[model samples]
Target: MCFVLYAGTSMPIPQKEWRNDVPGLSVEALTERESPIAVHFSKPEVRYIGSTSGCGCDFPHVMFQNGDWPWFDDGEHDPEQEASDRYNREALVNLLQATGEQTVELYGVWDGDFMTPPAVREEIALTVIVDPSFRFREQGLYVVRVA
Candidate 1:
């Protein structure tokens, strides 16, 4: 699966508070050995769309780059990269909604490990949302239309 990096204005709500929000699924939290940040989770049967980069790749990497993520701009840019960023942001939005968490302010998807083969990377980037509500009918970009 593709990797999406994310950051929010506030820390995610504690598992104790949001666990029950996702019905019929079990949530497991993980803490990185090198960092104090705890933003990883695991859930069974959660039909995640897009590519899967195996275990330990399920969580978004929390980034703090002085707020200089490339996607956070409105100037002229590459159309393909813009769409990829949008798709990732929309995925994060839907994920947060599904888990009953507040929307994050910064996030974007990338080819996991930066070592995926070019062909595989291209396919991952092109994975469209099959859910009608999230798919932009004419543009082919995925977005959270209902929430």
Candidate 2:
């Protein structure tokens, strides 16, 4: 899914610069998954899709771009597990800012064969795992949202 930012919006939530601290797959490769990104909505009638495994977490066993970073082994190993958290977190933050969501609570995350209904249609609830401290560290909040 593509996140389009509105014009004249505030800078995205102050997230630390992507440190490339975790090693993982390239961004392009992950986005090609069958069930990449999932958007959720609160109204249920509203039109939105929410879930996990989008943006940089679009692929399995791989993070953003397939590259070497500090957090992971960074030596020819799958970056999905270690990098997905951060990648998806950053993507969610960017999405909220782009859509003008001052404080978005990520509720859920889903990948191929993992999300409910098998395929996300539009307008639904979501629960996501986000780092509450706004830091790239592993400790964070387990957010939930109606999207």
Question: In model 1, how large is the Cα lDDT of residue 147?
Answer: 29
- The number of residue pairs in model 2 that clash at the backbone is 28
Cα RMSD for candidates in order: 13.7, 12.4
The TM-score obtained by model 2 is: 0.27
The global Cα lDDT (0 to 1) of model 2 is: 0.30
Best by TM-score: 1
Taking the candidates one at a time, how many backbone clashes does each contain?
3, 28
TM-score of each: 0.30, 0.27
lDDT tens digits by residue: candidate 1, 48-102: 2221222212332322234322223356577664455454445444555554433
The CA-based lDDT of model 1 is what?
0.29
Name the 10 consecutive residues with the lowest summed lDDT in model 2: 3-12
